[model samples]
Target: MKLWLGTGLVEEDVAGVSPLDRGFTLGDGLFETLRVKGGRVLRLDAHLARLAAGARVLGLPLPAFDFAGALRATAQANTLAEGVLRLTLTRGTGPRGVLPPAHPAPTLVITAAPLAPPAPPARLSVAEGTRRNDRSPLARVKSLNYLDNILARQEAAGRGTDDAVLLNTRDRVAETSIANLFAVLGGELVTPPVSDGVLPGVMRAAVLAEGARERSITPAELATASEIFLTSALGLRSVRSLRGRELPGFSVAEHLRTRIDGA
Candidate 1:
């Protein structure tokens, strides 16, 4: 696979690393997956903003890098129609002991690959794997430590499900294995509050604000919804059937999604 290592393009193996890299040894890193479409990587600013936020939380230095240049460089490196782009930042290599090194430069990698649009009306199984409460200081940060999500997704796949819905320690709906969660009830717009341990997805943030401003988010307005959806860069948004349970579709939400696209 071709990848962008900093500002240059290189074959995946060209930039070799030590087995003692902290990311492999202790999961000391973070990652962001973005979608590229129509010659533009949608929501690129939001992705970079979130990456900066995660790096801040982890005390990693930005170190004077132009990642957008790197991404564009990678896109130029290979020919791809449309694809999933991934950006990974690690704390770099370190010694055997657990104590973090005094001062370590960060490692950043970007890569892309061709991919198809995700299946529509995606059906997700309620995940058995639990989402631990907002304990980790990095709860809001996107960290490289993704074993939890990996295991949950595997559990869902094993059950022949398309995706997973995770509940928090308090049994409150938290998020899907990889996306945020929302529910419409009684004409009032309601989603599991962010404080409940949900990732602040860029789309979710836009929807919450725009949906409320235009009165398109009230659940009470839709006793019989005409659509239901979940969003991420790869899927943009996918209507849901939900683990054999049919969620009432909200015409308002669907309409808003259409408007969002047009705008």
Candidate 2:
């Protein structure tokens, strides 16, 4: 595979970073996973806009580059007409200690690879001893610090499930380990508000733009949902079951999938 590191495209085996890179040392960075179809990135503007927002919140300088152009170039370099593109940005090498350098140079890395075929409907379980803090600024940003998600996902895997649902500190359903959650209740499409410590996913935003409502969703509410699904840049995936109980049919989720595919 080929990747774009800093200014040029290079073989994946040749890509390297300094030992003191803040991103590697302290998870001090941001990233975006973009979907590429027919050589064009889906929601390019939205991804960049979100990255810009994250940079502003973290006080990290945006690296000077043509993001869209670089993405296209990297995809072309890899001969990827349909795949995933991961763009990562980090505060370049810094000295020992937590204080960021006065003059920080940022590192930008873009990698593209073919996407695997979509998987079957996901079986989900609520995480056992973990909760998202809705009030934390870190909850709103897609920083590299994903140990919480990693461990939660591992817990689900140990239980022989595809994913785990995370709740907020107040026990309101926040989202799944990797995707935004949605439910159809009383014939209305609803999802947990971002204020509930959910990542504002690009695909989630698209679904809302198509008329999904944002509301606080409790575990009981999820239990009573007529249908459930998860959204990510990859697309909408139906939830087959939650905590060992079968969910309703996937009609609503399938309809939304059609709408998104057509969009």
Candidate 3:
């Protein structure tokens, strides 16, 4: 695979980085996954904005590069017309301590690969005894420290489900392992607020801008939801079932998918 590593695109088996790189050692980094359609990246500005915001939150320096141009070049180099592009930014190499360098440089890596065919609709289960700290700043940013999500996904897999639903400390539905959650309750479209420890997903913002409401949703409320769906950079996907109970329909998910595609 071809990857962009600061200088330019390289055809390499492994992308190298310093052993002391904070991103590798301490998970001090941020990443953005973008969707490319017909050789063009969708929502480039929004992705960069999120990255910048995350960098500020982490006190990490932003790498000096034309991110959009680099993304396009990497996609072209890989001949990826319709696929996913992942941009990773790290707090560069540091000493053997937790204290960061006063003048640290940042590392940027971009990789593109063709997307596989869509899998079956997701079957979810509430994660076993796992909840995000709603008041933690980390909850609002996409940091490299994703062990919680990984473990939650594993718990779901152990139960033979596609994903796990994570709730916040208040027992409010936060999100799934990798995507934002939306439900059709009382014939109204609602999603858990970001304040509830849900990551402010790009697609989630679009859905809300396009008229989805934000509300506190508990597991009990979710059980009564007529329809449920998940959204991420990969796109909208309907939920087939939650905790072994089948959901009714996906009309709302389909409509949002069409609206996003049209916009």
All candidates' TM-scores?
Answer: 0.85, 0.98, 0.97
Count the clashes in each prediction.
9, 0, 0
Please give the ranking of all candidate structures by lDDT, highest first, separated by commas.
2, 3, 1
List ranges where model 1 is wrong by over 4 Å: 212-227, 250-253, 261-263
Whole-model lDDT values for every prediction: 0.68, 0.91, 0.90
TM-score of model 3 (CA atoms): 0.97
Q: What TM-score would candidate 2 get against the native?
A: 0.98
Candidate 2 on 1-263: residue-level lDDT in tens? Answer: 89999998999998999989999999999999999987789999999999999999899999777999999999999988889999999999999999999889999999998988998999999997688889998888899998889888999999999999999999999999899999998899999998999998999999998899999999988988888999998888999999888986999888888888425
The best candidate in terms of lDDT: 2
Strongest candidate by TM-score: 2
**Tens-digit lDDT string for candidate 1 (81-133):** 47778888888889888776888867788888887745666677766765736
lDDT of 3 by residue, 5-53 (tens): 9778887587788888899999989999999998889888988999999
* Candidate 3 global Cα RMSD: 1.2
